[model samples]
Target: MPSPARAAAFAAAARTILAVTLAVLLAMAGGALAADAPAGKAGPEKAANASAAGSGDDEDEDDDEDEDEDEDDEDDYEGMPPGDGRDEVFAYCSACHSMKLVTQQGLTRADWAEVLVYMVEEHEMAEIEPEDEKLVLDYLARFYGRDRRARKMGR
Candidate 1:
């Protein structure tokens, strides 16, 4: 058998070789990932430049399209009526989810309260203050509760 010192030296050399190989592999993987990344967003700048170089026709059309898009963006919260709790609900809920999803639900006040609890416990929504929670619950119960849903169904 080899001497203990020689065996320890061989083991240390093997470990060093393995560590260097792993480092090189990780570096190569990082380079490949960087190389495969999507190209930067120079698309709109190019389009604008091209439009500038051309006649005014494309620029006018683009302006009209942008105006239409702006209007649609403004209507994103159209379903939620203006009310006391509207701002709170919008600020809290819409941070993560679309307001449309909130407007579609129709639950009783108690159910709405439970939903808030669920949001906190299950989905880790921020805890609303007790006073704010009451306001939000009242608003939901008034506008999106079962009675509103029933009325919509002509009940």
Candidate 2:
């Protein structure tokens, strides 16, 4: 039987070995996941821009057709109702996330204001200019407000 001090030392060494093994396993798993991930997947902003700019390919004729298609797609706002501040809302919100995420919400004006504030404060979103903020709020309230259900039902 080992002395208590030797036993404690063995236990400590075993813990160290276990920790190192876990760390190595975690690292290998992470690397494997990264390797398996699709090459076409990208961050939100990059994906949006890539979709807009078309696939970067060597075919020159296809590139010209893509450019024309991109021009037409520029005005497409992904189902956000057309309104006075549609451009501002699209430019700001779509920079970080899909416009579908924005259009699906049916919050009141105050709730929308709170969400914008939360996004800026917690998510490090760029602060909207005061004039643009007002326009965005108004546009959201008009088209996507809580009353949207009633309006849609009536329509």
Candidate 3:
């Protein structure tokens, strides 16, 4: 029969081998995910290339079209309307989800405030600064408020 010390050493070695194998498997899985990711997904090299490509193209109309395409590629908050607090709302909300999730809502200002609180408490979203929170609430209430029919009719 094997001695206790020998068995312990064998067990330890087996565990070490298992851990190394698991680590290698995890690394391969991560590599596969990265390979499958879309080409335009965020990367430092892609950002530098986008900006550099757009900078020198101001002299030609065709270049302007190319620049617009580049801008569209980088546009994360495409559906949100232009407004005073649009940037603040987009920067905060789009970190976790698509801007369409926000644009489809038609809540009053108080309900919008409640949603923000719910996001922070339930979904672990970061709390907005007080000033920025006010701006975001104002923007949401104005553009996505409950009187959607009225606003559309006016337009």
> How much lDDT does each candidate structure score?
0.71, 0.76, 0.76
TM-score, structure 3 vs. true: 0.51
Location of the lowest summed lDDT over 10 successive residues in candidate 2: 38-47
Model 1, range 32-125, lDDT digits (tens) per residue?
A: 9786432211222343354367545554466777777546433534456645565566656775676778888879999999988999999989
Residue 131 displacement (Å), model 2: 0.3
Report the C-alpha lDDT of model 3 over 1-155, residue by residue, as the tens digit: 99999999999999999999999999999999897543334533454465578676356468777667656543634555556676677767766887778888889999999999999999999889998899899999998888973576675
Q: 1 or 2, which is superior by TM-score?
A: 1
Which of the two candidates, 1 or 3, achieves a greater lDDT against the reference? 3
Clashing pairs in 3: none
- Overlapping backbone residue pairs in candidate 1 total 0
Any runs in candidate 1 off by more than 4 Å, and if so which? Answer: 1-76
